[model samples]
Target: MYACIAQWIPPLERPRFIAVVLYAIGLGTAVALPMCGMVIDAAGWPAAFYVTGICSLLWCVLWFSIIYSTPAQHPRISREELQYIENAVRSSGTSHNGPTRVPWKSMATSLPFWAITVTEMCNSYGITIIRAQLPTFMKNIFGLSIKMVIT
Candidate 1:
């Protein structure tokens, strides 16, 4: 998303747009996590999955409606805004002549890719462990009810 923002927004606006996007992600997680917990308590874990899945589909619909290959291709972008973005991108020398082909083999062997993969694997392990065990741990050890654990 940060990468996408760099493509779609002008340089001066990128940081602000990225901050807004990050804030939105945090806010949505704060709200939706508890909502998922409540849904799980009321219906089941599967119900929580259903709710999130539907939300993902709706978000995809919104994304597909608004997104385009470039600022000029976007249906709702103003001429000034489009020109600003294009000029900024061009000035920065990041504008591509055409679709760049992925260097899949080189990427597979890259140190940065391995570093990111390892970091993500570690992060995912920690998050998954907390998600799977925290409620049970609180219920058993701290005597917290599902509602208390959620909130």
Candidate 2:
């Protein structure tokens, strides 16, 4: 989904688009973390899970209704916007015949690929630790309730 969005972004705006998408993701996580804690504290852990599940379902529905893999496929887009996107893609020389086959052998030996893999693993580990343990840490170390930690 993100790769599709990246493809649609004009080359000059790609950096800003990626930054904004990442910022939104981080912001959503920040907001949802405390909200989940509060929900768990108030209604119990099951309710928090239910809330999250419902939100996910709603997002899927909205995404299906609103997003297209390409600007040319978007039914609700204005003619001007469609023309702009077509022009941008044409000018960028990024239009493809179809999906290209991956160079599996090259990727397997790539230093940059290994670097990114390791970096992602470390990042996920840190985020998981904080997300899974922060509430307990706050309770034990700071003598704070779940609601208090969230607040």
Candidate 3:
């Protein structure tokens, strides 16, 4: 999804756009955490999961309905916006020919790939632990209910 958004953004604006997108994601997570905790406290843990799942489904539906791979393919895009995107793509010298074939065997044996894999694995482990345990930790250590912890 982000790759698609990146493709639409002009090269000169891409860095700032990506930064904003990342910040928005962080902001969303920050907001969602307390909201989830409140929901869990009110209705139980499964209700929080249900709310998130429904939101994900709605987002997917909206994305499929509104988003196009290219400006030309979009039904409601303005002519000026389409032209602007086309001009940017032409100026950037980036082709939309799609990705080159991966050298799987070489990547499998590469030290950099292994390093990145290890780093990502560690990051995922840390995030998962925090996500799965934070509420419990707060409940145990602070003697707070889910709503109280969040509030």
Q: Which is the leading candidate under TM-score? A: 2
| TM-score of candidate 3 against the unseen true structure | 0.82
Q: Lowest summed-lDDT stretch of 10 residues in model 2? A: 1-10
The residue-by-residue lDDT of candidate 3 on 25-100, one tens digit each, is 7687777789899888889989999998898899899989988887788989899998898789768886366678
Per-residue lDDT of 11-35 in model 2, one digit per residue for the tens? 7887788899889977988888899
* Alpha carbon deviation, residue 14, candidate 1 (Å): 2.9
For 1-151, candidate 1 gives per-residue lDDT tens digits of 6556657777777778888987896688667777877988999889999999999999999989988877877888889888889999888776777778999999999999999999999987986787667668888999987777687
Which pairs of residues have clashing backbones in candidate 1?
none
lDDT of 1: 0.82
- The residue-level lDDT of candidate 3 at 94 comes to 63
- Candidate 2, residue 124: the lDDT equals 90
* Model 3 stretches astray by more than 4 angstroms: 109-114
Q: For candidate 3, give the lDDT.
A: 0.84
In candidate 2, position 147 carries an lDDT of: 82
Clashes of each: 0, 0, 0
